[model samples]
Target: MNKPWSESWFDAYAPERFEAFTPSHVWAVLGLIVCALLLWLTRGVIRSHKSVSEGIRWFLMAVLFLSEVTLNIWYVTQRIWDAQTSLPLELCSVTLLLSILMLFFRSRWLYPIILFAGIGGALQAVLTPNLAYAFPHYRFIHFFVAHSGIILAALYMTWIEGLKPTWKSVGGAMLFLNGLALIVWIVDTALGANYMFLAGKPSTPSILDVLGAYPAYILAEEVIALLFFSLMMLLFEVLPGGRLYARSGTYKKTY
Candidate 1:
């Protein structure tokens, strides 16, 4: 007999995760590398001036974000609109949420970089074979439109709107995300679910193990995240206060 969704969800993910790299992880890492390159290319695109409609930008972004969230919620609640045996691929929700946060304020080139990351990341999930084993619904929104929707929104905002990141923004984002990671890690330790994959060696011996063991890996992640945030902040330093922010000395915005 087929497994119940609730029982399947818990069985699929409730165990402590160690060496957790799956095919999906391979795609996620590959996507990260590709998006990093795209981010660099986007840097040049963002620096050049452009003209676009803010209304369209907001409309598209709103639609993408709403659709992704709604589909995920429906899946989790098992409303049966398109139910699956399990709803274990909650990672997209977190990634898209962060991408959406980036889009919420930035109005220009910043959008596309974030969008590319969101889209690339989402697509990776769809293409990853592990997803099919994850849940039937993954074949639907999680793999395709939901992800494309996010990437397109991010790209629309970054390419057309010209979004830039500030030190303050980076600092806040890093602080919040890292703090949550810590809490989740703690909970994973207690519950043995490794909800965030922070408990031990990932499915593969990743860069984290190179850092050391548990607490050490934790520290390393903190340092790396801070460095990443700092790097993002430096981009804003080099960037001219966008024309709008220049007049106001507030990192001018387009939308």
Candidate 2:
């Protein structure tokens, strides 16, 4: 039986019709690749033209901000808005807001946070989306756009704006994440929500599934996050451009 499009798009807690790693997943992966390539290819142009770069950055920020607003509105209109899951407490949700701040102010302090969180969290979300809707669905489109936009913003800052992360940034990000995790843990305990997946691994099969179980997996996630942050810092160090390397002094405002 053919399912109604409205049912698929608006239904809360809809069952997964398309399995993971299927054609839909393949298309999502391809879309990410295209987004990455487009951002990389435009790096030189962004570097050469400050006005164009600012315009692009602002546009991306606006899209992310507006998409989130629209998503909340959709949830409300559908009468599915609940404190448990509707709150913007998830890592990707928080990072989307951080990405907006980073673009709006070009603050160096927020750069590492966005880069680490965006690459580690947002990239993973893209690779293994925990979504129910399929292609052409509003939720599907919003999820990919939001996740891909985050990655693009991070790469744009690093490769185009010449922002680089330092060893200190690795420590800062680890500390910040631990603090945020603690807060999320408390919220999850209170609301029985799974923000940041700290409460439990997702129902969908994910990299988290192989990490172990429950409390043990939470510890594993902490270790993984630190390692991911370190690897990201190393990437910036080894990249070709001198500007990509971490400078040894205080951060000065670039914007």
For model 1, residues 36-129, the per-residue Cα lDDT tens digits are 4664565555445343244544555576577666655655665443212223323455656555565566544333334333343454444442
Question: Per-residue alpha-carbon lDDT of model 2 for 12-121, expressed as tens digits?
Answer: 55554545677877898788898789878877777789898888888889989987998998899879999999999988898899899998888788888888876789
In model 1, the worst 10-residue window by lDDT is 81-90
Stretches of candidate 1 above 4 Å error?
Answer: 1-92, 98-155, 186-191, 204-209, 239-249
How many clashes in candidate 2? 0
Model 2 CA deviation exceeding 4 Å by range: 1-8, 11-18, 242-244, 247-255
Q: Which pairs of residues collide in model 2?
A: none
Q: List the candidates' TM-scores in order.
A: 0.50, 0.91
| Shift in Å, residue 222, candidate 2 | 1.2
TM-score for predicted model 1 compared with the true structure: 0.50
Question: Where is the poorest 10-residue window by lDDT in model 2?
Answer: 246-255
Which one wins on TM-score? 2
